[model samples]
Target: MQGPVVTARSARPTVMTDGARRHLFNDRTVARYRHSLSEGVDRVAERISGADRPFTGMSPQRLAPEIAAIDLDQPLGDPSAALDELETVYLRDAVYFHHPRYLAHLNCPVVIPALLGEAVLSAVNSSLDTWDQSAGGTLIERRLIDWTAGRIGFGVDADGVFTSGGSQSNLQALLLAREEALTAAPAGSQLPSDRTELLPKLRIFASAAGHFSVQKSAKLLGLAPDAVITVETGADRRMRPEALERELARCRREGLPVMAVVATAGTTDFGTIDPLPAIADLCEQAGAWFHVDAAYGCGLLVSPTRRHLLEGIERARSVTVDYHKSFFQPVSSSALIVADAASLRHATYHADYLNPARMVEQRIPNQVDKSLQTTRRFDALKLWLTLRIMGADAVGALFDEVVDRAAAAHDLLAADPRFEVVTRSHLSTVVFRYLPAAGQDHERADGANLYAREALAASGEAVVAGTKVDGRHYLKFTLLNPETTLADIAQVLDLLAAHAEHHLAADERRLVRR
Candidate 1:
């Protein structure tokens, strides 16, 4: 009897009840979750502040073993414990984009207001597809879209929808353009009854330096790979208006319909803005849809001192703006605005259970009517929160700061004999490459610069991007961080030079051995 006596024990998690739903209405459980989230945010903030480098470069060969050790199939039971493990597995080796030395790519250090919006929107779980799902979120998103259209000086009929990013925006814009072209075709001309028949005659024109998304969009839209016409660019890397005109004429002569003329507000590699006015004029004359991919340069919309850079953007039939890039907001914030809101009707697909035509007639604004996405995230809130707190002018000032910093970096690189810099930056990117000794061959110089970039990234002291300009490897410093300074650029340049020297000497040693 004494041996049979049992002791008190803690209760285990039960499988009899809905474990997921149990936490939903429980204040204690939510409080615990909140605490865990707060702890996680603090841990990340502390880790970033304490970090010495932008990244801890762990090659896949080395990282594989470490990643293999993690048993992702098992859950930790407690959020804090899970977060601690995540810190070891992810946060430790993660690239700190906020770090001044992180000069790679278009990633920017986000503003605090946007982060707050992210938290709120995540908690609320607003699906912005319909008014029934998102309620005020749909309205807020529409308001933000309207504000952006106004900034672009679009007409009263202008309208837009939030997209995942610039790529999605560009895709949706081209889809609309494709539909418009089909609708405008002459009565007896080669208007196809079938989808495949239209692929050959439809062409899109963009500068050589334009984002790769244009070509990718063509392929995705069932157009042939050669459907994208690469317009020649000037020495400054801006798309040449005369070249575009000739290409448009050639398309006309060949009986190929120019579906769209995609002008660049900001080319990715060179940060070049094309001759938008001339391009827009030509597109108007040719009866082609004018689309401005302003994903990189849309920040000029709010730029008080530099807004003139986007003088002819208002004439665009469609425009893409990535707030995530230029607005310093968090990722997943972009919009596709059209000069004529009626064009969005092309994307409208009404589901009986969701946004039906009756709802539209009743004046219930469902975003799905205009959006390519159904269950879309409320990314517009990020920019809304950003503009609300920071003010548009403040955001523009921040952009101005980085752009001015880019000019300074360009100057520094231009003056340095050890590096060969491209033309002055039109935005916050400086493309340059390490110049080996004067007598070195182009291949050797390319090898040095390529090796130097890898070495710099491997060292974790600095992170820079690389591109092939004119088939020669060139290193790039995408200066998106406003806090990054001339001194920081100097240090990065010095490190790059040191790495280039090492690679150059190693090459010499290899030649000697041979």
Candidate 2:
């Protein structure tokens, strides 16, 4: 093995030779990063091509000791040796989402065009915080934002900024809504000397199926715990317009300010879209801000056939779209778009060292002025590259294929006697649980279903997710992989049934022993 390369000719630090400086800096000529980058890519490619399963099925107990043995104080000093150690320590056991059997979360196998953009963006290291920091990069990001706004059918006054994820986007949206509400309140309604008092009378409304981030945002915004009022849902798990209207009327009678009404375009577990048109009308009548969390369903913007699902979305004052979820892009590709661009001024913070007022007067585009983050990544490149190469229609087709597969899988589960499938999929998720045998009660059924999900995950032949509906445990199939077929889902279902049966048999044995 090659030892560490040393070029120091003298012991004194200030008396460095030309070769030592070159080696330390690792410039183009000295370190040959081109070769190093190629090697790293090749290592990951080899790992992907050689993997036998989606996961290694290794328990944390066995992996912890191996990871703890690494000595961080001393460097490995050799690139090839470090790569070998990385392969053994991390890559061998990492959960590969690209595998056909992995249907756990909203994670999608990234597209090739996005990968190309990632490579270039990382190499260039452009920060989209200010216009001077990233001249052309700023323009590219703004142009992409404009294109997204146009697709959402927003008017000419619409504007937005990219965020870290759906959570951040939602938080920022609520912040703007709160600011807008405070600005519009009658004089003396809020004590300017003590604005915290207004939090008590402020309220936000969302469906029972809306993202948990709604309540989280309320908490973060210093509103009371009861500030978020969850409206009722019908049999379809969508928000009932009558329930929302009644709640709005009560808020008015109680002197509570309806700050905002959050509508979900696609929920997390069931993928159910709330009644956006009715909700929009209610918000308009109540004079409350309307926000749509379309993080998981924004892909329908380009979906040729399913575009009607997002009909009333354009009416939202602000909208959250996570391109990473449904656009086949990698993580952290989400934006918070607003219908009225002036609402974004609530997030602006003027700093003399960065985005100054002078720059704004000059009409120079500084993304930091509209973003919650100061130093943001150039994530727009990923979507730009995807649109340029694969075209938006191709991406939409892939999403449509997954939705179609999800429908077929729902039928397969519903037809099976062993499973009690939930409602028909509205987007691309099928919520269901394993049904116990005829003699078992509700408690036993829940236990058996929970055990089946846990056992399957431990076995690692297939990875799935679990959630609770109506206070009972249920498993979920979040189908985002277009390549995954019905056979794959059938095999996974077979595994789940076998595991549930094993758990029940073991429980019976325990009872007999007792």
Candidate 3:
């Protein structure tokens, strides 16, 4: 007796009965996966080509109801239908970072090769925690870390792990510093055997212009309210080494152990780099761990012309680099690299079922041993592919172009009587404010600048960031897109000026009515 033939048509009913079996990514569904991804790519490309600006200025109040209406429990079943629904809820109003006019934040336009890596990694779904889970992935990430450490001028002892972003990197770096401080405390001197008791006396020194993550990390580490001591910045917005020296001396006199001295390589608003060589000297004298938060300025590591800007970064005990910010990789591509590989042992925890002591004895590699996260994504693949396809020099060239563009934008703002430019940046950000008129008071100017930023976003012509400078409102343009031209900067400035003037006129009319 011959068995009934099992054809492709008969397998469809079984798959449909199982409901989601057909969607599983396997050899049998390879064609479906390819088709689905191609459809998505087409939709995104179409959206990008049609977009005229960086944003549609869609507000939460308007879009929230549309999203809430969707019943997630009810599957659309067809990929095409779900994508169509996505168009209305997401794709339509999504902020297009790739657009040249997106000057809002540290978000950079992604590169194609990195995007390719992203697709591949997501499909593979490899967890980077253990060698068994991500064999080649673990080695790939380690190699990329070594490559980055070499760029930062670290020696063979360097090691690191990929992180979600700069904040996590900073947190992990500080955690290591905290441990080192507790373990290395002097013999007698008021330092208690209980590390928890000493946490309050551990001080972290950072520039006033430094990232807020320093304070947040301290809180997460269970430090006192005043653990993060803010050192004043100079006229250039860089941390004043003289002020830092004074603070360190005061901490020493008070018997407060200096846990770390964080130097900013690229401040968020000012884009100024703290004097690294001077700060490194101070850290060494104080016996404090030196950590450089080069999240925004890490691009200079590969920069062909601006590498000199990050001169003292190599001296740091640990450094944070966000490839997403400077290297044009996608979101969540950052690393915390250390000068001494053994320091990462501070983050290690051996799980019996996972990375046990026996595995370490066998010399098995596990990324979780050096990471704050256990189930980490293989984000290093993005940077690997990016470097493989574009080369370091090409990436550096793109960053150099943006820095040159920023300098030109600064000059443009300075020459314009309608605007007041702040201190020039060493990186690729320009901070300025629209000056209403000669007679306008500080309060009115602040209001005008504030109103202009909001109005500009509403108008959807361009998106720019806003920050406070010396208690006054200022507009910021973070130039990460290499495609942005001088003409685009000029046009955005003109629009901002026009909006500010209108705001001032409206205020005058309301005051007259009163």
Compare the candidates by TM-score and give the number of the best one. 3
Ranked candidates, highest TM-score first: 3, 1, 2
Backbone collisions counted per model: 0, 0, 0
* Model 2 CA deviation exceeding 4 Å by range: 1-31, 186-194
TM-score of every candidate: 0.95, 0.94, 0.96
Best by lDDT: 3
**How much lDDT does each candidate structure score?**
0.90, 0.89, 0.94
Comparing 1 with 3 on TM-score, the higher-scoring candidate is 3
Per-residue CA lDDT of model 2 for 1-514, tens digit only, reads 9977666644346634543454442345435566667788899899889876678787889999998999998777667888999988898888887888888889888998999999888877889999888898899888888888988989899999999999999999999999988778777653343457666678999999899999999999988889999999888888999999999999988888999999999889888899999999999999899999999999898898898999999999999999999999988799999999899999999999998899888998889989999998999999999999999999999999999999999999989999988887678999999987888665777888888877887777888989999999999999998989999999999999999988888888888899
Instruction: Work out candidate 3's RMSD over C-alphas.
Output: 3.6
C-alpha lDDT (0 to 100) for residue 122 of candidate 3: 99
lDDT of 2 at 72: 96
Better candidate number, 1 or 3, judged by lDDT: 3
- For candidate 1, which ten residues in a row score worst on lDDT? 5-14
